[model samples]
Target: MKKSQDDAKSLQERALRLLARREYSYAELMQRLSRFASKDVVEEVLDHLSEAGYQSDQRFAEVWIRNRLQQYQGEQRIRYELRQKGIARERVDQEILAANPNWPELAAALYRRKYGEMLAPSREEQAKRMRSLLNAGFSYDQVREALKHLDSEAEFD
Candidate 1:
């Protein structure tokens, strides 16, 4: 009984230390703690931390979204990353809506930052640019809008 209590205390301490550095989703915390203890023990500690309001999936999601936006990542990429972190789809959607990102503007801005004002490139060059944007998680329409914006800007220059 004493050993069990000590183990739980150690686990809680480890969890608190991790939480102190940055927000972690419950699942992330579980995964990290599982390496140190059994699933039941990890769950118990996580539950306690959560009850104490030291761990929050909502806060984790919000911070993650904000950081991703600062990196100029698109919505699809952010959603996929949050899902991989075990955030529920409903919560992901709610946080995304709360963030209220302007997807088209962001896409255009990302394109401008990456490619600059050199317009009317070769067909191959255009395809390469499209691929880069698509891989960055922009959808077809969003990529097209960005390219269109680029073309218009080039015309003005």
Candidate 2:
């Protein structure tokens, strides 16, 4: 009984410490806590914390989305990453759609920053640029839109 109480206290403290640094998804917290405590204890602590509002998947998703947006990541990659973090598909879609970022403009801006106003002079170069943008998580439509205006260089000043 004493050992159980100690374990419980330790788990809660560790959890609080982790949460203090930054937000964590439920699965992330559980995986971390499981290293120190039993699965049952981790579940109980997580439930209590969640009920008390210390842990929220919704909040985690919102912040994660904003952070990824600054990195100019596309929706497909963002959705995949959020799912990997244990957010449900419905919630992920809701959060992403709700944010409603202009993906085409974003893609164009990123393309300008990387390749500049110098047009791809050959078919191979155009295909290579397309592949780069696609690998950076853009959809085909967004990449095509970005390609159309490559000559209009962005004014950084």
Candidate 3:
């Protein structure tokens, strides 16, 4: 019917407006569009947009990874976030592998930016630093390497 056609058109318009603002994963767009229309309508509109190359999970994943890296987030955090956004595990792994960031160096850089040079940090201070790095999604090995490298630098200074 005309009403259904209008609904699809409006949904497509809304989707384009959103895409104009930023890249959205298909899952994200679905969540957003579902609020306004039925699941079938939203899916159809999204499928059309996807076919038109206006929506892409792969592009969304790539852009998301790049932005997170600029914020100095680690691979684990990026992977978790991408998954939360409905990106598949294989896609997440592939994008992360494509990124190929240096984990230890990134951790060390983040640490240096945050805590600075600590000539004689106490055990408590060390623990705090380790916790911060871990929470930032750095692996144990990466966190240890970061602290060890910084501690040695501080000792020499």
Question: What are the lDDT scores of the predictions, listed in order?
Answer: 0.89, 0.86, 0.89
Which model, 1 or 2, shows the larger lDDT?
1
User: What tens digits encode model 3's per-residue C-alpha lDDT throughout 23-64?
Assistant: 999999999999888999999999999999999999999999
Tens-digit lDDT track of model 1 for 9-39: 9999999999999999999999998988889
Q: What does candidate 2's lDDT look like per residue over 1-157, in tens digits? A: 9998899888998999999999999999999899898899999999999998999999999999999888888778889899999999998989988899888777777777788766678999989988888877889998887777554443332
Candidates 2 and 3: which is better by lDDT? 3
TM-score of each: 0.93, 0.90, 0.93
The whole-model C-alpha lDDT of candidate 2 against the native structure comes to: 0.86
Give the Å error, residue 15, model 1: 0.7
Over all chains combined, what TM-score does candidate 2 have? 0.90
* CA deviation > 4 Å runs, candidate 1: none
